[model samples]
Target: MSDEKKLPLRTAFAVSVSKTAAALSRATGRGDGSVIGGRLGMMIDPDLLAHLAAGREIALVSGTNGKTTTTRFTAAALGVLGDVATNSFGANMPTGHTSALARAGATRYAVLEVDEHYLAQVIQATEPRVVALLNLSRDQLDRAKEVAMMADLWRQALAAHPKVHIVANADDPMVVYAAGAHPADEVTWFSAGQRWQDDSHVCPACGGHIQRGEAGGWACANGDLRRPSPQWTLLDGEVVAPDGVPHEVKLQLPGTVNLGNAATALAVAAKFGVNPIDAIPRLGSVASVAGRYAQVERDGRLVRLLLAKNPASWLEAFEMADVAPTLLAINARDPDGLDTSWLYDVDFSPLRGRQVLVSGDRAMDLAVRLEINGVPFTHVKTFADAVAAVPQGRLEVIANYTAFQDIRAELDRVL
Candidate 1:
């Protein structure tokens, strides 16, 4: 029903082939098929994304963490408008993005979760109407640039594309510096409250020490940098709008972190003409994002999946864990980040005084960290073994990237 332009003959052929490849890939159970389809499309036409995204309203979500969840929330909130095509399976890169758009059909709106490193390329190709900059921290050190370098890249990208309206997290110094690079009028700031300040101690502007005050207040030693007065603020578990009205947000997902994600999504939704009251309830209806907070029943046991990829996310995940039996899985796969040194950065103190089941390829490494933290843990060889070790009641399972996917796949096989 969209008035969007039709694809060129060659590009249309590429899309058909890609869709057929994706169908075959899904039927064969080789994986999600997003990557294969997108790869083949790109092989046929390097500009496949531009063709697919033509005449559509695009919104891009980018950050070090929470991009997947925030993209889901933003898409759900925008659903009040109409059909929103999104890469909900966590395929955020160019190939996956191409696949998502290629299959979007007549959908006129898209909410895309973009990799932080590829934000500039995607923005240039799609010419998104709104861009959500969540937060920045060290992630995938082996594959990603340094935090400062990423900030600089974002600054340059925003400066180059001044027409794109930006919704950025003001609480994060790196995000502040990056988004602040654009014309101030083009940016709308939101403070979701930073729980992990260990990585943001130094001011990105002046390299001076950053100060954190009580109740999410922060200032920099140098006068050049400080937390901006956010247009949207999450105060006391509610999102406060510019009109000084508080909209209570209840999420099926757990943790204060999800509250922050909701606030960010609301800001983006408002930019797209959705009222905060309408968008807030739509965001709260999101039960789970991808497999992040999914409650799966396997072998007569309820296992809740929680994902944390870095120290910042891990700190938040630990806060959300219940006192019930817990399973911690860590992997050093390419997707999970090979450098396990970040394990030491997390305060595993909450895990103390509880019997923790540690499993994954890097279980022993986590065991050593837990031992030093004085957390009682048993290192299991397999995810099934770890699940079996937990008592037969409500259980919590937290894992890094690859481990989380493997556990979900294994559960799907049996359940």
Candidate 2:
């Protein structure tokens, strides 16, 4: 329970204005209205987010990847207890948090998807009951902090808020280092496996080599930093809860990465006093978050949309996608980070035998990378072209941030 206070007159006015602006934005077909609404509200009252988060139980999910889906899962799992207000769309900054809280007035619980860079700021404002750290990796490096720097920010934030319980990944060294800032009892560890270890070869504590054990563990060669023993562990499609109870996880979302997210969500739900048995079923209820894994029918072909912003996420996307012809869209927009150089960081070898169709503003960059990786690809202009190039069947379309929105827009318009 939180000491939620009555909103001040000014803040109430700001909230009202924000909701109106967001509704108008949607009504006018400007956008989803989440960002516009929150921006207007925050402009009216700069401290609008803190003011709204004053009296509710908050859980924040932050990481380089999977934060959005993990936040969705945490919110759904929390549904077993009561209604949870969350930013269902990918608008995951201060403005988005303000809009979500303002829109869902009087909700007792909120599970927010906080951008990795803004994790500290959100923690300071919301004073969340539980902060779930999924995994720290290289993402949007041109706009965001480096992996170690982001981990340090998380460390400082957790240290400042000692009372906030932490549900963090033990497999990721950087996540372990950050979550270690909290005292033992205040932290809950989840052995959600990290598949992309490109950014965490060196220990964050010291520049020592991180030695990984075959039995799922890691330690710094010359420092005390090591993988924590997780209370909740994900084994072959099942989660073993803290009480040593094993519950099989069956999710509508694809891939083993989502299974790890399910484990992390269950851990966060447990901190809020939700039973894994009662909440596990709710986890299955979420088929997609935002438009990440949504399958839309275009030209009699079932096209699945998967978003991969960086190398780490691209790896997971490859695993989730089918072996059929795949469309890879890239963009260097502000939201997608103005660097396609990260494409070099992704191993495109998985699409070697499969048909790969490249599109978007950075299609040439993606094509060159695929060529270097010895993968064959055909360049296309639009989503319709990509669909036409393939036969009438399942086609997987993977894209970065803004390009994904573009395809989704075209998808809606064409349908």
Candidate 3:
């Protein structure tokens, strides 16, 4: 109400109308309405997002993978200061950001998940206090920009906003090159171990081979490009702060990838003046992120959901998955990237010893890839069939974007 008084009359009306539209969208069972509402609000007032973000203590989380989960972590850590508004869902675009800020109305702190490609646009609008650069990899090749291009965009954005502190992953060469655009004092580097080397083998600064060290450091074979020594590091479930104080990472999300995410969150929280030791418990409280690692009961069997959008995320998901009956779902829909060719880049060997079932709109494509990889799998027609095809005690489901949403909806209906 106090903030509304500061808004121009037309912008205030646009906010009200967008809220009504969002509520109607929810009533009609369309979706969460975050995107639609924000779209409408921006249509009325083109600068609605910038206006809403003007005075907030904002921190943005962006990357090819783990944006949603990392944003959740940052919000929870910042919750130590006050009520932190965030996009809990996977909506990371301008429209989603607009809706979130509009709904949260006057929250002092806001942590927003930003899509990798839209990082520059969001940085300009939010002018956040801190920006967390997670990692870069080949994701949605048909739709999104290449990793190098994204890194370049980030570099330009950071160069323009020298005042904003950058919390960067030092293990990722792409991240290092991009965040290196800022002055060293303004950037806080954290090494959490980058699992996917498929995208970062080449030096972003020069056309050279990036030689990765056995200890997780790297250097350019042709030039001076190399991994920066991190102020924060996540090594074997322990997060070491800049002062060399190590805090044990106790996370419910499962796997080292989530631990890496926790490290990034802690660094961002530290920039916001929250003690890293105090934020550990808040990070542990995040059990599931937008249905990524949720375990649901189906016919007395626990079904765990793990979302993997690209090869990089799939590798992490495989590590988090248990040695149980695993269901792999792939969709070539727009949201899931119409090209299913990225499946070739992923090594599905982890599921070789377990009973595997494949299902989705692109089940045939997935089956062919599995066949080529010598990974045995059964092709099922529907989610129910996939569930019944394997002996049910504990089942792990991995799906990309839209397919993941579909499975979650089906689980809601069935159980």
TM-scores, all candidates, are 0.95, 0.96, 0.96
Q: Summing lDDT over every window of 10 consecutive residues in candidate 1, give the lowest-scoring window.
A: 1-10
Model 2 gets an lDDT of 0.90
Q: Write the per-residue lDDT of candidate 3 for residues 1-415, one digit (tens) a residue.
A: 4566556886888788778888888889898889999999999888899988988999999988888999999999999999888988768999999998888888999999999888999999999999999999999888789899999999998899999999999989999999987988999998888889989889989879999877997999987688888998876679888999989988889888888888899999999899987888999988888888998988767899999999999999999998999999999888888898998999998888889899999999999999998899999888898777777588999999889989999988221
The 0-to-1 C-alpha lDDT of every candidate, in the order given, reads 0.87, 0.90, 0.89
Give the TM-score comparing model 1 with the true structure, all chains together.
0.95
* 211: Cα error in model 3, Å: 1.0
**lDDT per residue (tens digit) for residues 1-415 in model 2:** 2233534776899999999998998899988788989999989778899999998999999988899999999999899888889998869999999999999998889999998888899999998999999998988888788899999988998899999999999999999999887889999999978888889989888889999888788999996798888899976678999888889988988998899899999999999999999998889988777888888887889999999999999999999888999999999999899988889888999888998999999999988898889999999999899999999899999999999989988877331
- Local error of candidate 2 at 260, Å? 0.9
Error of 2 at 222 (Å): 0.8
Q: List the residue pairs that clash in candidate 2.
A: none
